[model samples]
Target: MMLRGALVPGMIALPALAAAFWAYAGEHAALSALAGAATVFVILVVGLLGITAVVLGPAATSMAGAGVVYLGQLILIVTVVLVLRGVDWLDGRAFALSAIAQTLLMQVGQVVGYVRARHEIHPGSLDRGAAS
Candidate 1:
């Protein structure tokens, strides 16, 4: 459910960014960007999936469950960074930049999803009717 909103922007961005990097840098940078973006997309989806249960559960448990899921997500990212650091072929700068871009795009998607969700739960039409 959450993955729908979170993944859209990243998927839309990947091809354009990869093509741009290919034009300016080379095959290596382009592949690096693709790899980085893919890695982030997988991680984000996993994180969102992990939180789905928490988000659907009792309100009181939501915050604590989210906290744990996020902590694990951070650790997973750090591990990926460390493991990738030893690679010789990957362009570090391109990889890092692509990851950052993907992360930002996902954040934007999350915000949009939140707003959409809020309206669905308590739309203005309902409020106006209540006020009548």
Candidate 2:
């Protein structure tokens, strides 16, 4: 559980760092696109976390923490997107497609990670414990 908790932040940090790098490089257009995409990603992650929290109750600590991080990221992304849109750097279609694609990719990543983590934590415990 501790290891999983540690890894959750690391998982989020990758995309956050990438977005920050793009923003820092003065690639305003690219940064805006990335920010828009990140917003969608964060929304999807938060939705997933909410579902997990409902199902798992108090055991959903990691998911809840991840959701909070995603929320913060979402706010940053939305602010960047709005700023870019106001400045005329982001086109409608490009912005929309970027957000859609990022959401899909983030969902896939989350599902895969969840499955992999479950397997790691459970291993053969279910079968072995059942036999005992």
Candidate 3:
């Protein structure tokens, strides 16, 4: 639920983070940050698509599907880092820092989006988590 809406805040955070990286660091760092941050966003979107497929299936299959998606994403992310590490123009410090920050920001966005949205767990739906 929150994952769809979470992207907005995540997008907003990127520019701010990039500006900070540019100001405190330098042009190379800024470029590295932009690349790293954007890559994370793309990876997250792709993972979401993979998970969405899981959501529409049977309960028995859902857990395995979700696990596979998560594990696959982790492998993809590590592979990206390794490949990027070999690039002569890349800044490992900036890339890793930016990626970590972007990840945390996106997760925070998801939580905030979830809290702000109306959900079935509230009093309006059938399962209110109250004793009858």
Candidate 4:
């Protein structure tokens, strides 16, 4: 569900990031921007999948497990960025911007999911129709 939520945001962020890089830094920077987006996409998906398989799957429905998974993923993301920062193929500014944006949007999606989930689990708790 988290991944699904990110789909639309990714669609929006990626193209905008690309365009921004192209306009500000030219074709080479645009390439780096796309690469940065792809890298983040792969990292998040794989990290989430790993977490799902290892912790979330067995725990099933446990929010604590999800939190742990997210913490781990966050650490992994930071580590990856630090390690790859010096790579020649990566445009540092573009990579930093896109990665940061992607990560922030993912966090926002998670929060929204949590809110919707809380509402679903308790129906009328968040229902605007209740006032009608």
Candidate with the greatest lDDT versus the true structure: 1
Better of 2 and 4 by TM-score: 4
lDDT of 1 by residue, 23-58 (tens): 989999998888788888888888888898788999
In the predicted model 3, the residue pairs found to clash are none
What are the runs in model 1 whose C-alpha is more than 4 Å off? 120-132
Give the alpha carbon lDDT tens digit for every residue of 27-88 in model 2.
55455556566566555555555555555666647666656766765676567567666766
Instruction: Rate residue 109 of model 4 by lDDT.
Output: 74
Predict model 4's lDDT versus the native: 0.72
| lDDT (0 to 1) per candidate | 0.84, 0.57, 0.80, 0.72
lDDT for each residue of candidate 4 in 79-117, tens digit (9 for 90 to 100): 877888777877888887778787677657756654554
Clashing pairs in 2: none
Output the worst ten-in-a-row residue range by lDDT, candidate 1. 114-123
By TM-score, the best candidate is 1
lDDT score for residue 31 of model 2? 55
| Model 2 residue 26 distance off true place after TM-score fit, in angstroms | 10
- For candidate 4, give the lDDT of residue 10: 66
Relative to the unseen true structure, what is the Cα RMSD of model 4? 3.9
Of 3 and 4, the candidate ahead on TM-score is 3
Worst 10 residues of 2 by lDDT: 1-10
Total backbone clashes of model 2?
0
